[model samples]
Target: MPSSVPPFSELLANTRESAVHFEMRDDYGTNPRLEAWQRGERINWDDRESWWHPFHQTIADAVARGVAVRRARIVSEPVSEYIRWEHYATHANVMAGEDVRWLPRSQATGFLVPANDFWLFDGKLIRVHHFAGDGRHVSDELSTDPGDLKLCVSAFEEVWQRAIPHSEYTI
Candidate 1:
């Protein structure tokens, strides 16, 4: 790990070619929205004015600057509540100009999936996220190691190839 890992926004802002994210978790613990969703609350996808937060704005800006942003998720079947919410909320990501996909865990058998979630920037740098057993975010680990980068790129590409695009995936 480096002494200093730039913030995600900075990394995305600096990206010139592409930014790819791989999420392999069924639930992200401690999220209030997930809790709300678990209680049967629905997200207002049409309320973009209020829902387009800074993160989405950053992604939108990056796309405007020609950075191809894509996200792929490897999820369990009969998806968890968190995943269901994620699926419901994916329209926002699509509207932000991100390409998103979902692949059931059963279909990811042969790929060398990384243990942690990560954002790979421009095929060179990777910001890997660590989480506690309870799904609380721990810290991010950044790396530019060739082996790590290669694994992330290969694994993500494979998952992306096998995943169903967001428009077609159903929870």
Candidate 2:
């Protein structure tokens, strides 16, 4: 059997005209993979590893190529800890020179949905989905409608305008 998969790539390609999107809730804190990674434990990189994905190459490609990547996070205390444990400690390994835009939930446009939550990326908005709680599962789904992406783009703009710069927030 193949080590990697194709459906995720196909989905991302479908949304190339717009941004990729996802959402999560406090339940994400209970994820085991996340707990281990947060504690600086080693994580296997093989296919059988918990929530593994073969898609980091693509996300890195988008960032390195200077495509505008925007993210609206519902910042909680645990998520904040995860960000520090993951991103700040490995900044050199995570991203090089490209600007990363992260925003607070209130600044973002859409309200948190009752289920998996609402997301519009590259002109598509999806309300219910799941996340692995670690950096392993690449759940980026593509949008079929350009108008959906446009709406997301507009939402990102509204958040981007009111959010603090990463430079200011990163300490």
Q: Assess each prediction's global lDDT (C-alpha) against the native.
A: 0.90, 0.45
lDDT of 1 by residue, 43-109 (tens): 7776778678798999999999999999999999999877888898788889999999999999999
Evaluated at residue 106, the lDDT of candidate 1 is 91
Per-residue error for 149 in candidate 2, Å, reads 5.9
Candidate of highest lDDT: 1
Deviation in Å, model 1, residue 169 alpha carbon: 0.6
lDDT, candidate 2, residue 37? 67
RMSD of 2: 7.1
Per-residue alpha-carbon lDDT of candidate 2 for residues 124-152, written as tens digits (9 for 90 to 100): 54432445655343353433466554555
TM-score of each: 0.94, 0.51
lDDT for 116 (candidate 2) = 39
lDDT of model number 2: 0.45
- Candidate 2: clashing pairs of residues: 18-122, 19-122, 122-149, 123-148, 123-149, 124-148, 124-149
